[model samples]
Target: MILMSPAEPGRKFIDSPAMTQGHGTVSLKSRNRNSRQLLSSSEDEQYQKERVVSPEIMCSLKSRIANKQNVANVTRNQLSTSHILDASANMTISKEKEERIRRQKEKQEEFRKHLIAKQQNNVSVDNTKNYCDDTALLTRRDLTNTDENSLLTEDSDLLLNTTKPSNNKSVIIVDSREINGAQDIVSTLRFNHDINVVAAQLDSCDYVVSVRMGVDRKQWSEFSNGTNRAKMTERLLEMCDFYERPCLIIEKDKCKPEEKGRILHWTKYVDKTLVHLIQSKMTLFFTENQLETASIVADLCQLENRKNCAISCPINLNTDQQNRVKFYRSIPHLSYVHCLFLCNNYKTVASFLCSDVKTIMTNGKMTEERASNVYNYIRRTFDTQMLPSNYG
Candidate 1:
């Protein structure tokens, strides 16, 4: 309030005012800059957190997508495998169907052939009846009416007594397959004729007639009577026992003329398999199919004066003939064909037997003694033109 040096005091007060105003303005500016820096830093931190969360979400999505893709690939693979399996199964089914169709076709063909045969036979019978009827129409009634029954009876008696076998002379027809009941075929003739049937192991009959089908090119049986193999293979035991004679051996097969060795046939095409059984040792009436050599042997057997003759082909004797030959047939567990291969050789007859002996002995569990006995006996019979003495 004192007016002492007014200019100096006024100047100092004015300078203080100016300095305070400037400081206040500077402080407000500094505070504004600090607030802006804090806000910018907070925005940068939020941006960083957003970047981290975005990457995490993206990675999780990518991983899930990859898993889905892998699952799709696995499903495709499984589908492919299933397709392959189904295709293979279809192929197997197709093959079975083809086989069945083939069999059915064959059966139909056979049935057709049988029908044709029957038709032809019926036509032949009708023609025969027509001819007989024509003959009756041409004949006079008085001639036909007189003593018809008596004349028929007389002719039948004459026919029955006329077809007698040769006296003590035996004719045998050696064949492959055993005929069924040969005795039945000729027994009526024997009963009406003056013939005696011997009960011995080896009996002789007159004029034996034989027939066979599908005989092998070079095979013969070495079995004797009363043996197990012989019993099984000999389907026509009545013929062998009572026929007591050689019969004609008529074989059925379309064998080539140039082919060598004897023909073979077996009974029981699917089962039992009785095969290559020799019916007799007398004569062989070969089909036009056998070779010259076989035909020659058949001729030798057919000679009227001949007593006993071996088959055209060499025979095997060491092994049980029935066992070895029959085994290859339809018989179960009896066929050693898998073990021992086929033998069509026709050497001294023993070659077939000797070569197959080892297998036979092993299969039959036969002793050397038993085998030797068989061998010696078979050799003797083959060499001596006699039935095996062993046949009781």
Candidate 2:
């Protein structure tokens, strides 16, 4: 055995050759065997050192591993909690968006409905204006004719052509309690020379009937002590039953009842009374409520006649009447002119112009010469200007 010094750190140990080696050369097999023995010893020593650990170091290692595992678990839990929070936040945002959208849709729907109603109201007003214009044109044409006698005959013939001749005389039943000088107005009309007008008290007349002027709340209350409105109504109906041609005139203002449905209820009552009376020749009229002037009352009385000529002439041709006619005629002419310019109705336009001119002549507003000139001028304008280019 040869003595060997302890190897230095990080240095490999080298074996010295023994004196028995031949020619100072080591055998390859022997060297390989020695190297293997050295390597085995080192491996055994490393294994023993690894197996012989202290209790404190082992416990420290175990604690360190446990801490690492706890940290990993905490990280996983935090990630899961963050994911849940993100999901809840996303849901809240989505709900808010949905709510806002719903509100926006509702607002749009409301605006649409309001727009439609406004348009309908505008259309109704326009239609009414057009109708008034047409009626006015007809009246003006009749008034402005040059040949009064011929026009009058023509109007009579036209009227007669539409209706069969009747022998029934014009009889008006006068209500005893007329208001606002209505009685005096009716009295004047009764004496007029134009028509064979006959007037009788409400109780005596069968065809035409007029109610007292003060049918308002105070008058109605005083008439029957506010006990029964139907009582006065019943009395009026009974008076109307005796006539062959029954006509009922009610004051426009006084016909209203205090309660909403009372008027409707009263109307039903009147209707029922009429049905019971079995009178087929019944006519109803609602006149102006409050008449301040006698002329107004006279005008109303004229309107009461079945003939259109009844109210055509003003009671007195004062500035007021002239102004009224001019104002009334002017509005319709404006509308008619507008219609003429836009519409292609030459024959109808010519007839309307002729009729208005005739009416003006009959009313003594225009001379025959002036009426004729107006008729010709309007007719020429209608033919030349208002007519369509294609229309002959």
Worst 10 residues of 2 by lDDT: 209-218
lDDT of 2 by residue, 1-392 (tens): 75545665322223224434542455767788899999999899999988999999999999999999999999999999999999999999899989988988888888888889888987687556544654464566557643544555455212111111132223333344442335544555455422223332233222221111111111222332335556655655443332223444444334545553444224554556547435544454444443322233344334544433221211223454344334323422121111212122212323444465654333333244544554565556434576577855
Number of the top-ranking candidate, with lDDT as the measure: 2
TM-scores of the candidates in the order shown: 0.25, 0.28
- Kindly list the per-residue Cα lDDT of model 1 for residues 287-386, writing each as its tens digit: 4422432443334334523422212211223565445554333222221221122222222223434433332332222333433444454445444666
Regions of candidate 2 where Cα sits further than 4 Å from its true position: 1-39, 47-61, 135-139, 145-392
- For all candidates in order, the CA lDDT equals 0.41, 0.43
Report the CA-based lDDT of candidate 2 relative to the real structure.
0.43
